[model samples]
Target chain A: MRGAVRALIALGSATAVWLGLLHLLFMADLDDFFGGDSGLRPGAASLAARHVKMWSEPTLKELELKKMRQSNAEWDFMGRTFLVLALANMSLRDPGSADKYVDVIDRIIDETIKIEAEHGVYYFLMPYARERPFMAKSGRSIFVDGEIALMLAARRIVRESDEYATLLEQRLDSMVHQMKDSPVMCSESYPDECWMFCNAVGMAALRMSDVLDGTDHSEFISDWLASIKRNLVDSDTGMLISSFSVDGQAFDGPEGSSIWMVAHCLDLVDPEFARDQYCRARQELGRSVLGFGYAREWPRSWQSPADVDSGPIIPVLEMSAGSSGMAVLGAASFEDREFLLGLMTSLKFAGFPVRRDGELKFCASNQVGDAVLLYAMVQGPVWASVKRRWNEAHVSSVGWVDKSVPVAAAGEL
Target chain B: MRSDFFKLPRIDELLSPRGFLKRAAVLTVVFAVFHVAGLREMTSFLCGMAPMTGGAAKLSALMGLGYVVSYLGFIVIVPILVIASALLLVSSRIWPVKPRV
Candidate 1:
């Protein structure tokens, strides 16, 4: 009887201790893990260290890019764009280190441009992009034009460049013309397919360009917003659909992977609309259970098979790696501290963070994933700077006021 | 301790508190070996990166998965075993068992 009782005690104690620890860990505020003060987050700094090493060493970068390029060339392009965005924010957050960050940013921009020139736009796009001819007369991709413009605009936001300034103007003019020519008021990412994600990013680049060069895209931006609001939104969910055809027919419903980022980009274009979409996405897609937060690739009313953008979806949990990664941006952008904490908990639990020689990388995440996390960690300063400049420039002429930038609540993490 | 590590244990001893500690220690050492061997970097294959430049992608991915499995065991399972062993020892002392008839 005693032996049986002892065995029962052992099993019961084990269960209790295990459950208790997991509860404490998941429920505990992860602010320290995410770090305090915008750019100084220890996690962000470690990720930056790894990226800096990768950019500085050609052999290392070659290996990493080769792997990503093999799976999907789009990752190679996206990895560069996100890292540039992160470095730009980092530069703004820490001005003392701005020069070093700018040097790397220039190298990335120059190299990316060189590659695009040597290879065609299809080089960076997926293989299917070549399956059809571009609908635009210029035969240019807004995916390529928009991201390249954003990269240039992000760089100039930190510090002006005469060369990049001229380049940015050319790209912006070309993109604006293309959007106006399109029936849907948005240019195509793939032939006959317009992604709200890419269009929102293009608008953000336009907004930033207006702030930088004293040009006004407010009217154009408003028209684009109206076009999307009217045509691209899912009627059932009240959230923006992921993609549409040039004639404004919906191709995909509201997707967690696309909407989180689209919501983030929309903030720079239209704040009220951005918040509404974010709230809807939060209601329809975001989830928290046992204190660990994740996002689904599709809402309950809509579902699609997994794609390259959605990554792998966990069955019962319905958690998407790609959407959850981008959800960090949404949570950060809207100051959703509670959701941010939950997502960070899940990331820590499953991201398999390995720190070595003062640098850290999540073994479960690739270069683009880490870069996106880094951007989430240090996003505020650049957006705030852009909004401040835009408001300052437009206050008298456009009758705009400076709204407070979204600040992630300090202790809630 | 080093000399006895390789010796086979009887079933009774394997279930004892000392055996649990031994098992935990063995896991710790093995995880340490994998960590020191730089398998953590290889584990990037989890995100679909081909683990190494010149290596066979399959082999490198397998090694990375091996390290991840070992790491999960070390971090999640080892502590539970250790705590359960300590609890078992305390339970036995508090209510001593009579010898088998």
Candidate 2:
């Protein structure tokens, strides 16, 4: 018994020392894990860079195009979107070559929009999309519409295009119409299924509206918030549910995989709400051990199965691919550098090998998975600039005053 | 009467450090063969990959537990055994086995 006790104490002491050392190393600014200064850190950028360089030459582009021709045409399209977003964020950080990157981005946006218009949104959406019509009367998906709009908005921000501006406005109008029609002011992406992800995309669209047209949908945003508080938010946790029925019935509870990025998107619509959700998520979901940060797909009490969205769940650790990818956006948005760096390190050590030639592929992830990672890396500048502009416009009487003045003048005169 | 049946190999040969190292090397090679053959997929049991398909929940759970143990044995125990054998060989060489003094 005495020997056993001594052994237990020794083990505990060693574990404490090991963990403390790891924390100290992590806190010491050991390396630029996010690839901010180091270029691409192994996760998504490598894969994207491979695709871009591969497609840069005509022969490689033809080969890839031919290979993807029969498979999910959506992968080809989404790959372009992911690459463009990655480049846009990269451009902000490295301004000397911003224009060159922006040119590629513009081409991608033009191509994606053309494909969607020609083939229709159904072409890119999953097979279940055709099984039942969209709940929105006009049959537009917030998923397709919001991402495309954001893509256009991202391109226009770098370099304005008249065509993109027009396209963004039309999509925003459709989204607004759909929102106004729903009693809960939430539009569904699939047959009665309203996903928090799609709602986030909707929020992104609203943000782009403020950016492109200088419109303040604050009242509409407020009403929607009230509705979400009433119906969508989980009562105990105060986190947003992953999905809901058209009538605002909760389908899936708050998911770590979805809510982290959703919270980042919510920052655009409602900053206070976004912060609250993020803090709750961080408290409930984010975990660190031995200086490595990983997230569970669900809270301890909320049970969920592994799906395409959550990717594979690592047992014992309960680390999730989707949540880990989305956690980047959350950590970066909140400036949780310690957590972000830890997560990045863990990703490098565990996720598939990263090559120097910029051919990064996670052994455990698929195409869409990598794309989301790329999105997280390059996300900040666009959202930051838009949020900054909104702050300035709100503080000053610039755009809002001019519109309000005409109505007041008409009343007075 | 049992002398012939109980006879043992020479202590000089059996306890030689070089002989121990040769055995350790053989074990390592065997472990490497299993590792490179993609038996690591078995480790997916620890990661909650399905152990049994097309079965009732109770039976599947039992099979899953079995797979998890076997997989952990492959990944964790095998590595430990190989490492221990190597350490034993190296220590014997360094200490000269003390000649049972």
Report the number of the highest-DockQ candidate.
1
Model 1 bad stretches (over 4 Å): A1-13, A23-39, A402-413, B1-30, B53-55, B87-101
DockQ of 2: 0.07
On TM-score, the candidate that comes out on top is 1
Q: Rate the local accuracy (lDDT) of all candidates.
A: 0.83, 0.65
TM-score of chain A of each: 0.93, 0.82
- Poorest 10 consecutive residues by lDDT, candidate 2 chain A: A398-407
Question: Estimated TM-score per prediction?
Answer: 0.87, 0.73
Q: What digit string (tens of lDDT, one per residue) describes model 1 on residues A1-413?
A: 55655655675788677755763554534454354445467667888999989999999899889877876788899898889999998998888889999999999999999999999899899999989888887888888889999999999999999999999999989999999998879998889888888888899999999999989988898889888888888989999999888888888899988898888888887888899999999999999876688999899888788778887787888888889999998998888999998888878777777788979888878899899888888887777878878866776677655444333321111
| lDDT per residue (tens digit) for residues B19-43 in model 1 | 7788888888888898888787676
What share of the reference contacts is kept in model 2?
A: 0.00
User: What interface RMSD do all candidates show, one decimal each?
Assistant: 2.7, 10.8
Rate residue A105 of model 1 by lDDT: 97
Computed on C-alphas against the true complex, the DockQ of each candidate is 0.38, 0.07
